[model samples]
Target: MTALIMIGAAVLPSLILLVYFIFGDRFPEPLGGILGTFFFGVLTVIPVLVFAAPLTEVLQPDLLAPIARAATEGFILAAIPEEAFKLAVLVAFARNLKAFDEPMDGLVYGVVASLGFATLENIAYVIGSGDGWLSIAILRALTAVPAHATFGAIMGFYIARAHFEPARRRSMLFAAYLVPMVLHGLYDLGLLATSYSGDIAWIVLGLGTLIIAVVWALRLQRRLRREQQAMLAGTAAASLAAGPHELRG
Candidate 1:
């Protein structure tokens, strides 16, 4: 059925990304913790939708100019509030877990939260499309879902970096919030531009922005994975040298 396909479209991409990041982790997180983070991500959407309506209205102020209003909504209103809430959820619910031991954990939790948000958002968009639900679902699967995952990856990378390298915590913490916020704003701005300009060029710009965002995130993830792998190796060597039963206490 169409509804089933739409659901698949919403969930499958998130799951694929989730699996990719989860497996890449040198220290696997607890399944329950990961699911809880995902659930919190779903919960964050409610606040985003509720706050976004008023925030957009307040930020725009330009009631008569459609393009200006849309652009403002995309960059200032929606991006800031949405990513802010996602960061809040990460800090409040996911960050302090005992399983959050390494840099990869930050990436895992960030992606989990982002994918959860994307999955719910995707379902709504797909269903609202009515007869065109399939096309809508497919389009979002390729674009929006991956975008959220990449944004989350950026957030996670900085968060873990801040944790491991405490001397640089101040800068890394700021980046944990700012990088994703800017990227989200840019992506949304490009999408809104296509509507305002009615030019295929806007679509090209949007796709280009997406490619850059994804590449940036991937590079960060790879670097973090390598660092975590080395840390894990060092920990294992220390543990073995300490003797089998002589655990840290």
Candidate 2:
């Protein structure tokens, strides 16, 4: 009962986002969007474990003891694997989707995929903690849920540009992947530092970084909207200029 409550809390935010996507005009078909989110979420975990398990074995006992000592369990156990998984999933599934028509669609799909991951992850955490539901709920709400969502948003923002703008596709794609990598790496590093030093400052810094990511995501959203509007306006004008006979609509 307690575990279910915790999972509910953790899943709520992502589910809210999912609802938004489903009802919103910007998203693809409702069924496709929902399936896309679930499919990518499941697919991401496999590659994440594949890469992380070997890395953990190599790093923990054999090499770089000092660095290992400094690193938080979360860094080795969660951050690297999770981020890599998200990237792999995005590349494998999202890049090929026809729904990726506009820049904002990138953000939409990215958020969906992230939400799927967060939902599953939240369920696992809630079940494994064996703690009271409230505690687990609070922890997941404060940390995991937002972090995963932000990571996905960052990736989606850039991917949208890469898809829509052919001439700058390479650059956009690079930035898309690179932005998330840097942010994810910093998040892990900050958490590691905080755990090692037992310092509130490192934790504060990590929170600040998340705040910045949010701001960046909002700005990108606005920019994408403006660009999409402009494109539509231009298309409308061109059709108008073609004369009434050519304009079937």
Clash pairs, model 1 backbone: none
Sliding window of 10 residues with minimal summed lDDT for model 2:
21-30
- Candidate 1 whole-model C-alpha lDDT, 0 to 1: 0.83
TM-score of model 1 relative to the true fold?
0.89
Candidate 1 lDDT by residue in tens digits, 1-249: 768877887788899999998888777899989999999888888898888778756765366365575568776677787788888767777888888877788888999988888889888898889988878878888999999999998898888888779999889888999989888887877787777767666676668778988998889778878887788799989879888567554
Give candidate 1's total backbone clashes. Answer: 0
lDDT of 2 by residue, 1-249 (tens): 655566677678777666654444333544775587567876677777777777678667334443354453445666656766776666677767766566677776776777777787777777777757568777667766777777778888777778778899899878877777667666666666676767767776667777777677667667766776788798889878887867565
Assess each prediction's global lDDT (C-alpha) against the native.
Answer: 0.83, 0.69
Off by over 4 Å in 1: 57-66, 235-249
Look at candidate 1 and tell me the lDDT of residue 108: 84
TM-scores for every candidate against the unseen true structure: 0.89, 0.81
Best by TM-score: 1
lDDT (C-alpha) at residue 6 in model 2: 68
In candidate 2 the C-alpha lDDT for residue 203 amounts to 74
Specify the highest-lDDT model's number.
Answer: 1
